[model samples]
Target chain A: MTIRTTLSAGLAAMSLTATLGASTALADPVTVGLITTLSGGGAGLGVDIRDGFQLALSMSGSDAIHLVVEDDAQRPEQAVQIADRMIQSERAQILTGIVWSNLAMAVVPSATAQDVIYVSPNAGPSQLAGAGCTPNYFNAAYQNDTMHEASGAYANVLGYENTFIMAPNYPAGIDALTGFKRYFEGSLAGELFTQLGQTDFAAEIAQIRASGADSIFIFEPGGMGISFMRQYAQSGIDLPIISAAFSFSQDVLPAVGDSALGVINTAEWSPDMDNAANQAFVAGFQEAYGRLPSVYAAQAFDSANLILSALAAADINDLPAFRTAMRAADFDSVRGAFRFGNNQHPIQNYYAREVVSVDGVLTNRMVGTAFEDHQDVYATDCAME
Target chain B: MTAALFLEQVLNGLQLGLMLFLMSAGLTLVFGVMGLINLAHGSLYMIGAFFCAAAAAASGNFWLGLIAGTAAAAAAGALIEVTVLRRLYDRDHLDQVLATFALILVLSELTKIGFGPFPLFLDVPPILSGTVNLGIAHYPLYRLALIGFGLAVALGLWLLIARTRLGIRIRAGENDREMIAALGVNIRALYTLVFALGAGLAGLAGALVGAVQSVQVGMGEPVLILAFVVIVIGGIGSIKGAMVGALMVGVIDTMGRFLLPRLFGHFMEQSQAAGIGAALASMLIYVLMAAVLVIRPKGLFPAHA
Candidate 1:
């Protein structure tokens, strides 16, 4: 299995670098390493992110950048090792493409400490936005709590009095609930946390049926969400559910089928958004990949554009100029207007999306904006000193 | 907390145990009869789920899909037994492990190629979709039916292995493989039959559970791990042990997650209770397995002994 994955990754890297190797007019090639989970439970997320970034790379048509992609297998230790290899052997000046927060936490701090610019396409852990922020680190995506906080705000809008909030028993899960509580005005009937990647939610379903909660907010991601939604629907629990986009996105909607209908989730981007950049991206992505892009894809595409624009603005030898150009956010983001906050995270809008049948398939449709021109609350904690 | 809730939980435990039993029974049978460690068993489970989901979508009949799924898994198992597994029979357990592990990768990749890298949906049949009022609490009719079906299969398996001539041959074969061969029994054919039967059971479990879980690649590995634990606790190579061990693991796991937090809540803050309780609940099964191993290293029912 390891050999097959390594061989495929090597082939992909070779093909990409071979194309860029032709543009040898530049003095020193700017190498970028993408370390993301690509072989395990949530591999779909990484695959989408990689595809989106690669789409951007091909579109940029620049021969100056050399891309090296590797799978971290969703392990923190593995991510750290990949980051080290990317820095030491690959000599990559820019790093991106981590899908999980735990992996980001392990890779970002250490990689940035060594002067490599870490552009996160997904997974904006709270620490990276707060006191632990660094000048070398930039989150082109929304903060980790953006969706959960938006869910909380939307739950208040929907007037759910007594809510039950549940998440996996991990740091990200705690951050999710904390963000939800920050805006939710209603009383919580119960709070629960299950094991990460738990396939069965039978006991948890029983508790939800009995909790008397008017609604539920769940943050189980990837396969965990699929299992929870299926079992929850099977258990005949019809309580209204609000959730983060991590669980209810387009990538997971098909697997869940009718079980996810009427469920609402929060996200920073949707494929149906109206804008020139977004329209081009959606059409190009669909034409190239034959599938609608997820929010993860959109964020990754934007991260790639941000890097490309920075590269266009400054030469590789000038570090200060490159950082300044990146901060300018001069690229046309798929999500209309975009800017970086003091903490290097995006200041963008969060939308409340309901799972609706689009073209005979389950997908999310934007209903309303939860946070317009939203920025992470932790931006104040970042000093950049 | 209430008797009704406890009853519902018990029913849920039974459903889970039965599912595990379906997977473990086949695993133990294959191990006992062949002495070959087959990690690709989970791949068979995945195949069953994928076939069931595809057939259900194509035919729009869940029952037909279930049959097709089980039959396909059996066919696949028999094919592997004849072509690949037969070679590993004489090899050491380590060789068997490596070869079977490689098979898992091959099967999973092939499934991904055939089905695409997306999860397929399988709906519960209409007849079992609704709820049943179990005196104090309402439960899903499908879950209740699943429990009944699993128990029936267990009984049928017991009868097949205990009453029939094939059962006698199987028992004798487990005791002494060479003696059975010298007695003019077609040991090769028997091994293939046993392996196919086991694969079919695993497939049935996958098809049954697919309705309640997303049918996707690698979905079988977690259930496979739990089934291993069940066999170890029940005493490996013993059908009855698999049943008992599955139920014990199921009930303990369910009750632990449901009750541990409440138990802790009585003495501490709710948040603290929830955190610590969930942590302990996740480890409860491993703790039970350790206790079982300490008491009976051969498991609760060693078929050979």
Candidate 2:
């Protein structure tokens, strides 16, 4: 995989320089560096993002953008190193496709400080969304807390008075619980900070059973979520669960299987959203990849289109004009009515989605609107010069 | 905590301990008999899970998948023992570590190539799906089944070591490898058999636990770390120590996670207590290991003594 990525990147760079030599002024080729987790535990998310981004580029049939993809393997140091190499050696103007927040935190600030355009397909850490927000940074995805906040709001709508909340002990986990509490006007029956990557949840389940909570709000992403959901189902507690879509995303739904059926999750987009852009995206992704695209993929697809939109409106050589074009977000987002807030993070609708079997495949369907036209709270803190 | 909740946590601890025993038993045995440190033991566990999940998905029967998983792991164990580990047996600890570590990487990548990047689904069988009333607390039947299976395996292992000719030979081999080989025993074949047995046990644990957890490429590494701690606390190369240490580690870890936060909740805010408690709970097992080592340098039940 590494070899193929390097070879493809080399080919793209060669073609880019060849095109530059041929034409002096019109349609300058822009280089995009995609640094994501392509190996280890978190590979599924990165694979989806890469495939989604590639699919969008292909569907547009535009050769003006040359993408150089590298695997960070979910390591913060590796992401930082890749960002440096892409910036200094590869001369990649736009950097994108980091999956985890820790990696994003490591790479984004420095990348943007170097005057490189940093477009986030996912992993919108609160630091970047607030006081640290830079003019060179644009997040095509919702801020990290948006889905958790949406879950909190949806829980209120469902009339849950007491909810047991649990998250892994990490920066993002803290953010998740804090995000939920910001919008949730209810009593917390129990709050748990489980070990990150700790698979067993028997003790936690026992506590939940004894806590007498009306509902559960969990923020365990990836394998942790898969383990928790399966064990929780077998525990037979019968408490309704509310969570962000990270746990119920299409990348993991098959592994989670029937355990996630009918569970309510909140996200910016679902495969079943009733929009022309979303329908086309879902259909196009299925045709291209032979599977359903997760929220990560939707974000990456939007990120690619956002770049494409900017490229069409302005030249990359003019940094100021290109930055303005990106801020305008003049593209049809997979999630309808997408636009950038003051922080350059998306201000969009958050929807409640339910896991349902579609033709024997486990996927999410749109249930209801959790929050309409929701802008992140951190936008006010962002003072982009 | 209520008495029922405490009892449930105890049961959870026992279940976790037994799974660790299954993993550590094999690891300790290989270390005792051959003096070979096999870091790729976790790879065998991962292989077992992948095989089990794939077989279960293909055959549509959990039992068949379990059997296939165990057998596949045993075969892979034997193959590796013959091809790669045979060379490292005569090398020093560092060489063995390096070789086995490489084996882990190779095995993980191969599994990924075979199974793809996504985690596989492996559910509990219908017979063991729901919760069972345990007089005080309702516990998941599948977990109870796992505890029972662990106990059964432990009993079977004890009986094999104490009562069988192979067991006698194994004990003798552990005492003196040269003497056993001089006494007309095929030591190479015996080594292969023991390695396969250990691999099979690890694989069994992997298949059992994979039903509840995510069955992915690196699932075994975390458990492998705990298993190492179990063996260290129990005494290296001692199955008896593995059992006692596993139980102690399991119970203390679970209870710490269950009680520590609440203990702090008396003086501090709930969320602060939870964060501090969880941080402490994660380190509880290691602290226990260190304490055990200070008190009993040879572990609770050293094989040689």
Please report, as a residue range, the 10-residue window in candidate 2 chain A with the lowest summed lDDT: A21-30
lDDT of 1: 0.89
Each candidate: what lDDT?
Answer: 0.89, 0.93
lDDT of 2 by residue, A1-385 (tens): 6999999999999999988975853555788999998877788999999998998899889887899999997899989999999999998999999999889999998999998999999998999999999999999998998889999999999999999999999989998999999999999999999999998999999999999999999999999999999999999899999999999999999999898999999999999877888898899999988999999999999999999999999987789999999999999988989988888998899999999998999999898999998988898899973
Q: What is the Å distance of residue A145 in model 2 from its true position?
A: 1.4
**Each prediction's DockQ?**
0.59, 0.84
Query: For candidate 2 chain B, which ten residues in a row score worst on lDDT?
Result: B296-305
i-RMS of candidate 1: 1.4
Chain B, per-candidate TM-score? 0.98, 0.99
Can you tell me the CAPRI class of model 2?
high
So what's the TM-score on candidate 1?
0.93
TM-score of 2: 0.95
